[model samples]
Target chain A: DAGVTQSPTHLIKTRGQQVTLRCSPKSGHDTVSWYQQALGQGPQFIFQYYEEEERQRGNFPDRFSGHQFPNYSSELNVNALLLGDSALYLCASRLVGASTYNEQFFGPGTRLTVL
Target chain B: SQQGEEDPQALSIQEGENATMNCSYKTSINNLQWYRQNSGRGLVHLILIRSNEREKHSGRLRVTLDTSKKSSSLLITASRAADTASYFCATGGTGKLIFGQGTTLQVKP
Candidate 1:
């Protein structure tokens, strides 16, 4: 089975510009979450999508938004990107169930560089 | 703010030696997970310890959770150069997982 997959291994954008990253979750998984990993830091949760709706969100601002398609794929859009927004955008997928310990599978991530 | 913090930001050891990393979190969690990330790669889940559990082992990896102390440690025995990577600790609660800054481990051959 295929694991989580992300598109455009890398991207370059300038400040005030917008960019969109895509992700396809692992087979049999329905939940998708986005994260941002800055240099020398751990990933910070962006938001989570379940059943085509946002189920949970982190402390990110309104400029960061996401959508989940019916097929469980997801897109993370960052508007008015700043130089600080340059980081590795990661996508993780999990199957939510009664158990709260479901493992998350992450994609290779899209490296975003804001100039 | 991030919920978890890992100590010894970076560690370097010989290939045959053992490596240990510690993590401390600020809030209660249903479970804590460890993940490994190679350079320019995504995270790979390593192990998970529940709130009620104290210790768990998988292969060369041993994880211990001290809920009273709100801390967890990961031990990798007889490490190899391939083990070089950044290790992160994540706390899972309220349907969200918060990750630590991560510990960079370099196993020299």
Candidate 2:
């Protein structure tokens, strides 16, 4: 089976512009989460989606939003991007019913460059 | 932030040697997980230890958790150059996973 997959391996955007990254979760997975990994740092959770609804969110601002489709795929949208928004956008997936101890599998990630 | 913080921000060792990384978090968690990321890539889950567990082993990896101290350690034995990467510790609670700053490990051949 294929693992989690992300689209537009790399993207370039400028300040004040908007961008949307897509993610296809692993087979048989229903939950999807997005993370931002800046240079030289670990990933920062953006938000998690389940059953087409947001289940949890991190400290990110309102500019960062996401959506989960009925098929369990997800999209992360960042509005009014800043230079600091340049980072690797990672997508992770897990089965909400698998177990209490969730083990997330990640995708290759989309590299976002804000100028 | 409930993110965990890893010690020795960076480490370099020769191949065949063992590598150890430590992580400490600030709050209680349902589980702690370790992940490895190659340069410019996404993270790959390494292991997960629940709050009640103290130690777990998988192949060359040995993970020990001390919930009382809010700390965990990951040990990789017989390391290889391919093992070079950034390792991160993440604490999971209430459906959210907070990550640590990460430790960069370089295993030279």
Measured against the true two-chain complex, the DockQ scores of the candidates, in the order shown, are: 0.71, 0.68
Candidate 2 Cα outliers beyond 4 Å, as residue runs: none
lDDT, residue B55, candidate 2: 97
TM-score of chain B of 2: 0.95
Worst 10 residues of 2 chain B by lDDT: B90-99
Best by TM-score: 1
TM-score of chain B of each: 0.96, 0.95
Judged by DockQ cut-offs, the docking class of candidate 2 is: medium
Give lDDT per model, in order. 0.93, 0.92
Tens digits of lDDT, candidate 1, B12-76: 99999999999999988788999999995799999999899999999999999999999999999
- Calculate the i-RMS of every candidate, to one decimal place: 1.4, 1.6
Q: After the best TM-score superposition of candidate 1, give how far the Cα of residue A80 lies from its true spot, in angstroms.
A: 0.7
Show the colliding residue pairs in model 2: none
Question: How accurate locally is residue B77 in candidate 2, as Cα lDDT from 0 to 100?
Answer: 98
